[model samples]
Target: MAKFAVIGHKGRMGQALATAIEEAGHEFCVGIDLGGDPAPVIGQCDVVVDFSSPDALVGNVKAARSKGVPILIGTTGLEEAHFSAIDEAARDIPILQTGNTSLGITLLSALVKQAAERLGDDWDIEVLEMHHRMKVDAPSGTAKLLGEAAAEGRGVALDDKMDSGRHGQTGARTPGDIGFATLRGGTVAGDHSVIFAGNEERLTLAHSAENRMIFARGAVRAGGWLIGKPPARYTMHDVLDL
Candidate 1:
């Protein structure tokens, strides 16, 4: 069994992942927190699984790189500089990152891209997502991933045509506009739907996470699958071979 270190072990997803790892008969060697150096245990782990805040991931990435440990980052809300840093470190070690770890979400992304390509400009794409109240990011990372798929289907960059939930007095929906809507309350695990609206009928693709364990299982599976891979950047598609 591959020994792994879980950063943010006290947190929700991290705790669930730790339990899942143990249940799966893998070794969870260390639990790292926001303290100084995680060198005692995390430094020696074969892999580092991160589900911490966006701000803390950079340092964790740096530490993992220094120790020559492969990192799997599930933290969302990363910016340009963070991605740049990840890319820089990925040059030496394998780094796998994904916003959503559930197998269905990644498959949904594949289908969304295909639908976007087929619908072309005739359909208006809108993504709706809902999560728990404690979720830090608006629009949810899964929504953004779906938006990226939609943009790719239309042969456009996500940065160029993203309309983040228009407010009051919004005019007609423009061509090639990918919109996002978010809702957060209670303990809703996760819900996402992509609507492709046309003149006649609308096509909707959705996935609802009934329980949070799916995500934990997926994360652990990813960590186990990527224990000794080559130095390269991998996605959920790569992990699941989709």
Candidate 2:
């Protein structure tokens, strides 16, 4: 059985990951939380799963690389610099980073990409997501993932084409731009919908997370798949083969 180390051991996702690891017949080697250093325990693990804050990402990646352990990062709210760190570390060790770890969301992203490719520019694309009240990031990472998928299908950059935070006097909608709407409330696991609005018909692709276990299960499955793989940056797409 593979030995798994969990970063952010005290958080909601961390606890769920622990249960998932046990359920998957993997050994829980260690759990590092706030103020705990993963560098001390990383060598004992065959794979690492991180659901910690963004601030801890660089250090976590460094620790995993130092031990030559593959890491699966599920932390959201990451900035470009965080990804740069991951990319650098991935050169030495396998690394899989994703906004959402749900298998359903991964499949949804594939569908969103396919839909965006088939639809013409006249169809306006909008992404909507909802999360728990305690989630700090707006637009939820899953929303961004879907938006990125749509942008990929359209052969454009998400950073340039994304239109988020609409407010007063926004004027007319820009053609070919992807819009995002975020909602927060009442312990939601997660909910994401992508809408394609055409002349008269609207098509929506959606996924609703019933519980955190879905993410936990997916993360554990990905961590197992990542073990002994070549050093490279990866995604949930690689795990699902979509």
CA lDDT of each candidate? 0.88, 0.95
Per-residue error (Å), model 2, residue 102:
0.3
TM-score of each: 0.96, 0.99
Q: Which candidate number has the best TM-score?
A: 2
Provide the lowest-lDDT 10-residue window in model 2: 36-45
lDDT of 2 at 29: 94
Superposed Cα deviation of residue 33, candidate 1 (Å): 1.0
Ten-residue stretch with the least lDDT total in model 1 = 35-44
User: Measured by TM-score, how close is model 1 to the native structure?
Assistant: 0.96
Which residue runs of candidate 1 sit more than 4 Å off their true CA positions? none
* Per-residue alpha-carbon lDDT of candidate 2 for residues 114-199, written as tens digits (9 for 90 to 100): 99999998999999999889999988889999999999999999999999969999999999899999999999999999999999
The sequence of per-residue lDDT tens digits that candidate 1 reaches over residues 76-107 is 99898889989998988899998899999989
